[model samples]
Target: MGGIVPMRDAGRTGTLPATSDELSRLLTVVRRGRVLTVTGRFREPRSRLVREIARRLSSNFCDGAAVVAIGRPFGVRELTAALGCVPGMPFLPYGTADAVSWLAERDMLLVLDGAEHLAPEALAWLRRLLTAAPGLRILASGRSPLAFEGERVHRL
Candidate 1:
């Protein structure tokens, strides 16, 4: 489920191993409409590895998947923009349950990144999303489990 894909370093002139075969396998699972959750430390300042992984997944799922990256320092705008997010401010209102519910109905893959930093709120949101959106599949990357029933975990 994993292969060494070429990734670029920001300040260097070489490639590195950025993602695991496990990530590839997980992407496949997402393609097949299964929820894929990942737990680990995420360092930003986009590396070639991250870009490559995103590229592969985007190519495969395209309109059928969407990624939700939640973290402190909230660089979500940057990442989502990079992923070609359509221009709209859905997360502008804090704790808006209605907005969250609306987002959950889209037939897209969800990527919940950096949930470790916002465990309580993020987990609650995930739980609600899971319950509200039957067609939604989640791919979460955090340091711990959201602990919702039926979640499949992959550790890195």
Candidate 2:
């Protein structure tokens, strides 16, 4: 069920209106940092903001920007699938190391949405993903920050 969603610029329609000041701040964060975590309370529009920022900054990444829904317990299979990698033989499950190796050389922006309940295993894998993929930038939207070593957090 997991698939990569292309980053779409919300443009002038179908988007929550954001203050120019807030937009500017987020844009700066996306451009200047490798990891950004957008934090807000329940029912907030953090995902919208994350998507908008990803759209605006897509050009900076050579492999383009993609969104991966992280609302449930996610792991390497889900990540690999979202990145358009098919799950191989059922007896040989895709592992985190494989996902990391697959993504290691790509310069891309990954938007992770609804990560409030992300499992510890998934979070650990994310840490490894960031470590292995030097050209990768992650923009996450959740109720709490992912707390990666170099993560930049913006609270709404």
The C-alpha TM-scores of every prediction are 0.58, 0.82
lDDT of 2 at 68: 73
lDDT tens digits, residues 43-132, model 2?
347867787888788788787787776656666566666666312212222566666777787788888877665677777888888888
Candidate 2 stretches greater than 4 Å from native: 1-3, 9-17, 85-93
Q: Model 1 over residues 37-82: C-alpha lDDT tens digits?
A: 5655543422323333444675454334344444453333333332
Backbone clash tally (model 1)? 3
Worst 10 residues of 2 by lDDT: 85-94
Each model's total of backbone clashes: 3, 0
